[model samples]
Target: MHCLEVNDLVHRYRNGDVVLDGVTLRIPAGSIYGFLGPNGAGKTTTLRLILGLIALQHGAISIFGLQLAAHRIDILRRVGSLIESPSLYDHLTATENLALLQAVHRVDEAKIGDVLDLVGLAGTHRKKVGEFSLGMKQRLAIAVALLHEPELLILDEPTNGLDPNGIVEMRALLTRLNRERGLTIVISSHLLAEIERLATHVGIIHRGRVLFEGTLDELQRRRRTHVALATNDDERAIALLARQSIAATIADGRIVMPAMPNTAIAQVNRRLVDAGLDVHELHTAGDDLEAIFMNLVSN
Candidate 1:
């Protein structure tokens, strides 16, 4: 079952800035779904709409098969989020900061320390949030989100300004949460590399439209690849593959073939060898995540 769903969602500001135009998403349970887009691509706006931070201008949203409008309170109880800059109290210690929210959620007191330890802030017993590093502050905000032990976690730009080590830590934490706790995470980011590293599924948005949505494996499959093959007889190889319904052409004195997975490549190799052709060299490359992302957003 899907953890969250957005259908034909449309949003506009008072000034008529159409931030989202018929945006739709389906995030599966136990998935680290990457909400990817460039800045102003409506990633944040879509997230806010799902969180009910703003009134829905048009379209519908549902979580766990329950319409958000009809079950806002009930649905929200099973969701945790940290959008944009985290709201944190500078004067309060990590424990104290989470305590205030814990009171609002009316959760068990033990949850406070559980989340603190989960976010690696348990050691800072008396240190006020004011003196914490940027990474520490970010972790505290996540702890606040997890206090309720929501089934779904949504984070926007969770690693906006972290150092290399901090970024790695955040990635590991989210992965563990999904793997060990079976948490469904929706993470929005303009950072293609980070999302590529973390997301099992991806939804790419461009100019308020969803250009692509599918599993990471499916996305990779969509990457257009060309195989450059060198054989004893390039001309004969081209003719031979064409007869086998595999289109090929002579490019740069080598046969160029369309995208083929390893199994297909092996089949092609067997076909050529059986045709009395000596295969000498073969190379293939496809668009990476960054390339695919750029192509999607640019178009």
Candidate 2:
């Protein structure tokens, strides 16, 4: 079942500039939906409209079968969100800040420790939010957001300023939250690698419009698979593939095919050998998330 739905969502600035135009999405329950787009692409604006922070110019949004605008407070009770940045009191300790939110939301105090541990901040609960590192603070923000254990988790740029370790930890936490707790997550991020690692579904937005929405495999099928093969006879291999009119490029003593089936690589290898070319290595270097993102945005 779809936990969140948006239909023809249209939002514009007061200057009549359309920030979101005819945006629509259906986020399945218990799925990690990656809301991907570059900066100034209206990702945040669409999130705001869904959360009821701004009035929709046209269209409709519903959370868990309830209209977002009409049932604002009640519907929001089941959703937790962290927008562009963390909203926490710098003066308060991590635990204290989370406790304050617990008070406001009427969530149990016992949940504070559980969430802290869940986000891998159990040891830093007493640390002051002001003194924590950017990554640490981001974890605390997620901890606070999860204190109430809402069904849906909304996070924007959750790994904006983290080192490798922090990024891995955040990814693991998100995966666990989704897999173990069965929580639905809607994450907006520019880090394609991070999204690819965590999200089960993807929705690509550009200039306030949703360009693509589907599963990882579905997205991959739309894109071309690239492979790079290295050989001693670079000139011969290039000449051989080019003669067949294969779409290939050369870089660093290797021939690259922008799009070809896996089985075709064998034929190319056979052709190279038949041409008296010495094949050194045949390996597949599939396009990464960045490549996929660029292709979508460019198209």
lDDT of 2 at 271: 88
Model 2 lDDT per residue over 196-297, tens place: 888999999999899999997788777656688888877667777889888677876678876567688888889888878788888777666677789889
User: TM-scores of the models, in the given order?
Assistant: 0.83, 0.89
Of candidate 2, the 10-residue stretch with the lowest lDDT total is: 217-226
Model 1, 2-83: lDDT tens digits are: 9899999998889998889999999999999999999999999999999999899899999999999999999999999999
lDDT of 1 at 259: 80
For model 2, the superposed segments whose C-alpha errors exceed 4 Å read: 226-229, 240-253, 257-271, 282-286
Error of 1 at 59 (Å): 0.2
TM-score of 1: 0.83
Q: What stretches of model 1 exceed 4 Å from their correct place? A: 227-282
Alpha carbon lDDT at 84, candidate 1? 94
